[model samples]
Target: MKITGYTDRLSVQPGENIKFMVNSHYKTYKAEIVRLIHGDSNPEGPGVKMEKVNADVNKEYNGRRQEIHMGSYIKFDAHPLFATVDSFSLQAMIYPTTPELGTQGILTKWSPAANTGYGLFIDDKGCLALWIGDEKGNVEKISTNQPLIAGCWYFVGGSFDKKSGKIAIFQEAVISKTNGKFSLPYEAEKQNVSNERKVNIQPFADNNAPFLIASVIEKQPDGKHKVINRYNGKIDRPRVACAALSKEEMSAWIDQPSGKDLIAAWDFSAGITKKGFKEIEKIHDISPNKIHGVAVNHPTRAVTGYNWTSEEQNFVHAPEQYGAIHFHDDDMTDAKWDVDFEWKVPDDLKSGVYAAHVHCGDDADHITFFVRPKKGQPTAKTALIIPTASYLAYANNRFQDIPLAQLMFGRAPVVQQEDMYLGEHAEYGLSTYDHHNDGTGVCFSSSLRPILNMRPKYRHNLSPSLWQFNADLHLVDWLTEKGFEFDVITDQDLHFEGAELLNQYKVAITGSHPEYYSGPMLDAVEDFQAQGGRFMYMGSNGFYWVVTFDPENPSLMEVRKNYGNQGWKSKPGEIHLSLTGEQGSIWKHRGRAPQKICGVGYMAEGFEVSSYYRRTEESGAPELAWIFEGIAKDEKLGDFGLVGGGAAGLELDIYDEELGTPSHAVILASSEGHTSVYMPVAEELYFNIPGLSGEENPRVRADMVFYHTPNGGAVFSTASIAYCGSLSHNNYDNNISRLTENVLKNFLLDQPLPGAEKQQVLTKN
Candidate 1:
């Protein structure tokens, strides 16, 4: 028997000795023939195709062969038929064609004995056939029968298996055992594959039969099927191994070839568990001389950790490993990359600072390490500062309370005894706070920042000046002791001109919680940069509201709420902020500056920092070598581990690591660290602001980070109050100090860098 077309509407042509086979492969197959019926004038006119003979399908097979007799009755059923042209509706008819014997094919329903049933008969020509339901209601004879579908070939096959109740179809050419009985071969090592293979039945007889593709089939109310891709259910030939062995037999050999390796081999065979086993560690000892290192590149995935080899480009793998497995290696054991970046620092190399960054080929994760000289002790310079208004003392014009005042001034600021849990503030109205409670108090003045009105009063029995706000200022004294000239300016001196002093220094900063700000204080720093300046912002919740300062009423500026009164329309207080569609609502119209600004914006979906993108060593930033001195080799751009719901460290929000633009900012660190709130990163530019444009007009250019003007006017911001003290604790103070010294001596004091021969260091101590 020879197999012809295997399609939705399949068929087999007639030939005496040739047998037709049908089974799982032929479940949707059928056969038919078209004989032109003559009109009044001619014999070859347009007419319907007639079915000479057709075969019936019995059951699904596991490759085992089953046969049917040459003249056996073949039922033509269930396969849908469609009209090729508008001429007529396509029809099927048995030999000695008749409109009787129930023309439209029989509707097979749920049968208890079998998943599906079959019916067939033979023609006087010895051609195998069966009746399609009776068209004229004559069900007795085989001579009058109609075909069910068209576009198919048909012939007779051997008798079906009585016990197993199946019919097998041949994929390849095979001689028939009987005149019409054809044999089929079971699935074998034929393809040399070792994974799972699948086969399904059609008209599947709705008996809770499992689907071939997925695990389960959820039946819809309308009697249709929806396969549950996840769970498992009753499936036909569910999961057969590449070896065609059952589950028990396959599991027995798991330890030998390794479960994962074996699963990879049989992946294409049948559907199994979604999570496959991973291969054990395999270490290959290659000659150190023959290869510098290895490099594995995934075109589809991020290629990471390939900086220790020469010619680290990648090519497709050999056929053996192609699509052989489905899994994500935990520690990246399955793939190793080695590229010759030579990743080593020279022993005698001039020392300053260094950083090493690493990334995963799949863009999985990034880590960085900072390396500095161990010999020279760094003086306090770089400072991290935090500015808050949670501490402010005022009286309510009450009776004499001198004794209470003296006691409160001795220790820390006193917490309030009364809770204002009235009305909208009733959430924690009954909450009591002492010095040990570390909670805020409540005041009724709308003039102060919101936090100050909520500070506790009774707890400050020690030193009133040693409160939260004062504690941060005291940290400035400690940094100064370490030779760092850093100071934490409170809201008392929250002025723009105060920050513009950075032009005389360098590396001014901001942070995670300096929620209250003045417009002039913001503008003074921008002006300082109009000359030449550098700034750094490592905070969140930077700028979202507009604080109004009426010069005529000095100290009476309006601190607008998030989005006017009831918070922003988007996420209320935290996420919504006005936008100029450029940098951020915080700095956008803050005056004129010379740089295309891009940094972390004010407000966060939450305090949590999200993983975005990363930059590999391939990103050419030679200057970064000087900035991030002691970091790991394979790191990339990401968060810095200081982000979450209540973290104080607001990381850089906007950064294009790959672009490496001098104007383009590197706001966030190269890993999940801090969530940046206010980040100012830019070079310098010149522009004219229109005076009539309100916050839009300006004339002059300036830097976004630091200030640099020809008239010795500059600004120096050392971050928020708490950050200033935190930097001293970490020696970042020293870096900032040196940078300050450099700026003063070179730009403000009109001195050249150390390499210059004649210029004097005007700002040196």
Candidate 2:
């Protein structure tokens, strides 16, 4: 809890440099590099096995506490036009989600330290207000009598006339059946407000201060400007004019945002192609001055704007209706912390999962990162693809807070120290599962900040078991115990380099719970299989959700969840991702179910306890008998494990021929006896009815499947996230371990499989 850090990247090839940014409460901390073989701290398991590595960065160093500045806004350099302006008007289409929270600045060019300049804001009373300050610290403020309603679009404008010492502020609701929370039958009294007043003081214009939208700037003690009073909601088509425009002129400008009096007219829909936003961060200014701005942090874009009519749901087809940018006060893309140490991996270093271990006194933390083989220089015949994308999606997730945590887990949640810290310190950022302060779903997640849950020995509060990162280490430990030399790569590498990266190895294994997959990542794996590469899907709930990374920053991932077994749903008409302009949600909705690639798709999930797999008739077939060679046909497999006491718990998948499971695929084993807490996924149900729990539903179970692919390749899928957790049972001598080893060993051989000749004969007939 005292010393924590994160790497700039999730994976780096040998000979490439990677940096670590650390924050410490103590004066100094010791740093060492260790290869993580096993991370589960359960007494019944190996107990956190890590091998120390002699790296150049292993030394003690002075530590400094780093702070995270969290918020999203748009900023542009102070132009000469802003410095000379004596009388001006500012207007924008605003949708205030938390107008009553406090005073929120909509548009400003003011310096809080000097208290000088002009600004428009939502006052603490939730009313439209205009503010102007003089050089002597004197200020004039005017507020409307009526408070604005939340979740409704309003044309908000403020203006000042220096010559007459007059100020005016107005708000008008622009609501339709599909545009806002209320429709025509709703009362209009709280939707409109207007006010005008005369003041004696003239406004002071600061030339050095940057113009900002959705937030104000305050000078910190370090003489740097920091974002403050951030507005939470959406802002569309903000414009500035040199003259004191009236309510009518401001309304006209919303339709035609260009004129001689215009100083700056930011068109939020500019640079949008039929695909998606071309320059996502760049805000285009249409006026002659070209005072453009850039978005700070990653705000939700390509969202429904004030004028969206529900006629066109896709932003790519109607960008004009999707010009708004949703800004959240808690939005954070990067920590931007100073680097504490850097390490250039040696060319001969092994490819595996490694972490920078930092400790001061009894407090300690580990910053994990993956090391891949050098470019065009693979050192092993097998590779393990770390599910980095899934880790980011669930990073810093507050699962303990879920209302159904107890009901779903069938017990009270087990809160850890890391979980408590995340509840208190929210500056690090929210995960995709969390909603923002304004109650909108968070669609984007970044890895550039500290992720406490991604560390070794961390357990999820819901299941109180090893989840993504540490759960994957179970396979790493088993592979090492079996003396199998395998290289390590990540989802990031697979996404960028595609099939070429997987082609370097004969067999590829996936991490436990590769639930999120980008289109390119799926393509690469499929392409590898088509090219005679064997695959071992060692986990469950994989290749379910569709995700895409920011082209500019691969560490940032985006997902728009709508229909699925998810925590939150995207707003209406905003189900498509802005990064790739592709539909977001479960891959099955896009016609690429996981069953098509791995012969298994997510079916149900439970957290209370794990069951075991039962051998099916297919397992006794001569063509598939080798998979269960060492185990009796009647013996239960994976009956015990560190995860929920068995391997077939957690999330389970099934082989469904109706959902694209290959005709030749064989269901070697199927699990049974799940508790009633295990329920079918929402996507599988057409109606909300009873008898959907595991006790009644026939589909809530995991299936172990094997199928041959093109050329000499094949796929072996164990459809449960807890499968790997059972590998260390009985000191890695259990039936689950034997079954996995048999497939992996045969998968590594260059010769044809045991049943290849029989399969060929059947195909010829």
Candidate 3:
């Protein structure tokens, strides 16, 4: 049996207790502490490594039972009269997205055990297709003339006649068009696809089992039945007829799915909540036949429907639009199970990355979390605030499921076992890159459950190297090797405690992709820097996207990527977040560009190749020479190492005075030799031009920057996500490591720099 778990809290301090919640089908399980050494299982880099914590947590959770809540789904047991339908018709109102790719099941009565049944679904080419199989294993299939467009509602249906040996399908735009042409872009090609279509087909089949909506039951090679090819859009008012209906009759049924001669009809609007005529998770079939089914994957309810007029934003006001059910292939609200064991951190436990190591027979996995120092007790001069918010945004992302990513990466994807598990068990929920049931992009993400991609060795679809959480761990290993004692904190802590949380430490460090931030967290960091706390922003794209977390439920966070900057623009009136009611977008839109606090902000991103930084004349100026004390004047910093084999790669940031980069900020070394694939971030360019790549656009490269603030404060930015990955080169004795050591060793002394003292004298005058 499979097992999984989560904690009520993401991080805990010594002397404080945290609860562990588990969902498993096993009788017993054990938990123990395992200090995380390295998460990347890259054989060329660091292999997966963990060490047992000599604590007393190695105990079994006995007598635990699993609670069943397998998500919302429709189910109907077999009935003799319903099984004799070899010839039939199917109809549904659909609003689809990503219809051009991936198999999407709409209506089906297929049995994998016998491989004998019938189904009507969207094929890989986005065209509606009808397929039927007989006892002899012969199969018949045909599709519509043209593909359906995404983001538009359509009346779709098909029929089969065993007697005539012929079948046909009818597809039309829900909103009758004057020209009969729709214009929604295909995701990858950005080419417009239409919906007006007609097709013909015929099939003989055996309906010995129940019919499924939005999903199909398929037999796996392992001899187990599994649900696959879940629909990723709205499905409303579905019905089946025992006899073929004329094209005109089928078109009229769009508004009347419960017409006469029907085998079954479903009113999706019925039984929405647990108190509504039925208990939790049960959906009633408001039809004469009472073909009831349960909602599965917790497909979103109360959404804008196939016939929505865009006149109402709150679905409660428009009951018709609310009738729709949104089914995402990667949707999961929870995986209800029992706790394996709990940990009440001891009073003396050190703050660091720790894991709850679990094992059942030969199967094993680790549940990782952070331990921070007790409130008001600062244990180290340096504090590394984990970018946990960013982690949550990109958690177990579905980028691999998109064809656009494939083209950009220049190769077909290699989905690890972890990726396959995420697709099969959608109970874990969706990432920011995925769309919701209503064809709207997902804006909220939570970490209350296991985020498969946040572990060690996890690689992102955007980059071959480690990213977000895993990439940040590179710095952790570096600090250990260098014998630097550091305290651990998180973006959550910074948001909740304000600047006070960082006042205890002399310096604070950010991770490799601290992309999401709340107003309070950004303010706290700025205040800390202004009050003489040294800030080491070791990553590109830090403090970029704005986000807000649920105070009542700290595990969940929200973000809305409206049309301005990048990736999946939000629809009108939906940009205001439900959690905080804040207008969501990039930080730059709110006048808080990364340059404002760290003297550098997001500039560009590239994956295929990485380059190194070449020192500028300013780096050797008498006042800044101390930063390059041990390096030769001609030495190329971060020229060779892990992560693209150089420091400046992946997402990069650059200094921009107009965007609030300190007027006095000094650019020491600017990364050179980025390939043409590296281009300026979209927002920076008013319009696309020939010279936007790294080879031409001056702003496309990372510029290592340093600037001084009031009260002896300073900000040092590495300006590249790949910077830390090179810190361990030559066994931690490389120039990049040396330069970073100089910055931190000087900052940790808790004294002002030469320029800072001069500024202080001028202020006193």
Candidate 4:
């Protein structure tokens, strides 16, 4: 995999130092900072471009190798009982994901500070391996007979005896069904492999606090301990006994009740709540000594365990079945690279997108960051708040398996370099749309890692076309082309500063898919609107699913997808987001659908073809003629352009009074001639019935809505993701362009729109 990097802060001001981190396979590399000019792939449109900003930002660093331990494992605080142990027995259930990587740490008490400890891990040869290194670095290592296959559950463990001076380790396959339905693949049956090694009867590593699992601590020469050799795979209940157990005793412990020999046993599936899961920061112990451990990177919790029967999906109800932690070798939250260089934005720099462009031989990459005008400064009347949370949710996503993906695209997507990189590097991490090794869907995502798909020219794996960040760039390109001055504030900015961050701008624009929102973010938008701040929900599916972020842990974002308008459902009791204690799923389920603000909420979606919007009778009314000024009454708005070659297609929304569409809201236009594949949203249906398809359902279309809030605040929604992509077509002279220009002209004016004053009267009526 090629090296990539990201900044800690999305948008930075001059005098603020932003950390720059890189993940590289090579040691020698160069870096520099550049301003991003444009991020589009359309050969006909503005091509890939950038501008250099600083010479001091350019430098070189010999990037150190940092191993990302992917598998989730637990560690207990050291007690006199655990620390004094000389010989002990350890056992765990392992489902190897990458047995070929070799030397996967299953459990260990090894820390490099003391350079001593014992551990049970899978060897590089994919064999059950046991290693015991003493204080002097003297070691005894041994492995099992045959190779262990990947994705199969096995019972691998060992026992060390001080009196006998022998270390015994064995690897035996668990032939039974794993998730109650998944059985191990047929492998050649051979005698169980148990190896014994005679070692010096020295006390185990005396380091009192070096105990860990999945990784070993290597004390750097600089006196800092670095965690290394992280194992990649799933690790189940790992138990440690104070002393060695006989083979027969071990056999009994495997299928029978593990007796008092267990000094400490960790059940990785103990705590997650429906009321809120944020309280589950520590895993509760089941052993007599309750030395619970905290989960790092929150490794894929609520996953299926070896005991899962496939009968219960909720981990809360069947905790035993959800005891596994799946890990990967490439799960990076931050590259943590030594900063080759850092810069505070100069005060005079414009509020736009910028990046640190790094060149390493033939390979080149960019570490992007956004710049906002000085705090409290309004350089422009309008601000475009990027849906960065939604970007995080779909970051580095793999949607090729979704049945709708290919069917919606019509043809196979043209794979980009980022797509191929993602496919080859599954260790980079999974999107919220994906599932863990145990089959439970993934919900939490973090931006501390390299998200290749978030870059310019990045294309969707299934759609080939630009999506989220890249697709949003189409609108960015439009605003720049039209010479409209606007400050760029990200969803992160809205989350931190809340309403105050948006109050300065007369109006705020949203990129296409604002699918993820936190309570504060939603409140900020609503409060800004309630106070007369105009909102331009420029795309469909705005304010959709709920998400959570902790300022304490800014790099991590969490979501619990359950109960609405999505592909995968969260486990029942786990529907509440653990990060913010808020209920997940769609915002509509929370009684705050997008329609309440913009008069349009998600309705349906089809990717094959984008159709045009027909002007409603409401649009032609003399008072409302301004929105359609200079356009023929019979003209089909946005009939030909970029995305799907029209304005509405990929995903559409509708105006519905029952769903809280404002009573005085004017639906100026509605898209028509949609294909059958565009089906209504899941929440819109009470039952699976026929004719819920695009052509049959009246609501399967986008609504062009304009509504005035109190204090001159207004909301105009295009209600389609494909809307902005059409703006640059025909050299920006098309009907879509004209209509948008007209709206912007009216929206940018200093007073309430003349027609909207009448709507206010109608609202009071």
Strongest candidate by TM-score? 2
lDDT winner between 2 and 4, please give it.
2
lDDT of 2 by residue, 1-765 (tens): 878899999998888999999999999999999999999999999899999999999999999988788889999986888878889999999999998888888998877777788888988898888888898988888988677788999988999988887899988888889988887837776667788888998788863567899899787777655678899999999999988999999889986877778999888888778767787789999888999999988889989999999998889889889889999999998888889999999888999999999999989989999999987788999999999999999999988888888987888988999989989888888989998999999998999999999888998875648889999999999999999999999988899899999999999999999999999999999999999899999989999888988788888899999789988999999999898788999999999999988999999988878899999987898877778878999999999998898989889999999998977788999999998999998898899798889999889999999988877889999999999999999989999999999999999999988787766566556
- Estimate candidate 2's alpha-carbon lDDT, on a 0 to 1 scale: 0.89
The TM-score-based order of candidates, best leading, equals 2, 4, 3, 1
The residue-by-residue lDDT of candidate 4 on 1-765, one tens digit each, is: 466877776768755677777777677778877766557767766676667776566788776554343434445566676677877988888877766776667778775455467888777787888877777777778788577776667777888888888888886666555342236545535525678877774546566545666766566775555556667766787777877886666656643435666777777665655533444447666777776776665665555666667666556555666677666544444434455456767778888877776657877667777788888887999999988898888877877656666665666666777767777776667788876644556776777667778776676764435678778877777888888999988888889899999999888899988888888898999999998888889899888888877666776777878766665886434565555445678889899988886789988877667889998888878877777888898998888756677888788999999999988888889999888878887777889899888889887999999888988888889999889888888788878878887878788888887667777788889
Candidate 1 lDDT over 1-765, as tens digits, reads 111111110111121111222222222322221111110111121111111211222122222112111100111122111100111100111111111222211111122223232222323332223222122222222322222111111211111222332222111111222211122322322311111111122222233333122112335555543322111100011111112233233334322223321211121111111211111111111112111111111001111111112122111211111111111101010111111122222333221111111111221100111122122222222323334322211211111123343232222233333212111222111111111011111111112111212221121222211123323332333333444443233332335235433333443444334444545455644554454444444333343333433232222222222221111121111111111011112333443211222232321121122232233343235433333334443443222111121112222222222322122232212222222221222221133222311122111111112222223333322222222222222233333333333433333233422222211122221
Clashes of 2: 0
Best by lDDT: 2
Worst 10 residues of 2 by lDDT: 756-765
Q: What is the lDDT of residue 187 in candidate 2?
A: 70
Report the Cα lDDT for candidate 1: 0.23
lDDT tens per residue, model 3, 1-765: 265566667778988777667655567777778877667666666566677887777777653534323223455677543567767888888877768666778888776566567777888788877767776556666677577777767777877776676677767666522111244322513222222222233333444545788877766575444576567777888878888776677766655656656777776656433212122235556667777777654565555566655665544344555567667765554544445566789888878888776657754556778899999998898999999899888876777777677665555666776788878765577788776554567766777677778766667667767778778888888877788899999999998999999989998999888999999999999999878899999989888888877675577677878644455876543454444445577889888888998999988887766789999888887767678879998999999766778999988999999999977788999999887878777777787879788788777899999877787888899999999888877778889999999888888885677577654555466
lDDT of 1 at 162: 23
Once superposed on the true structure, which residue ranges of model 2 sit more than 4 Å away at CA?
760-765
Number of the candidate with higher TM-score, 1 or 4: 4
Off by over 4 Å in 3: 1-4, 21-30, 43-49, 60-330, 360-362, 410-414, 436-439, 564-567, 759-765
Better by TM-score, candidate 4 or 2: 2
TM-scores for every candidate against the unseen true structure:
0.28, 0.98, 0.70, 0.80
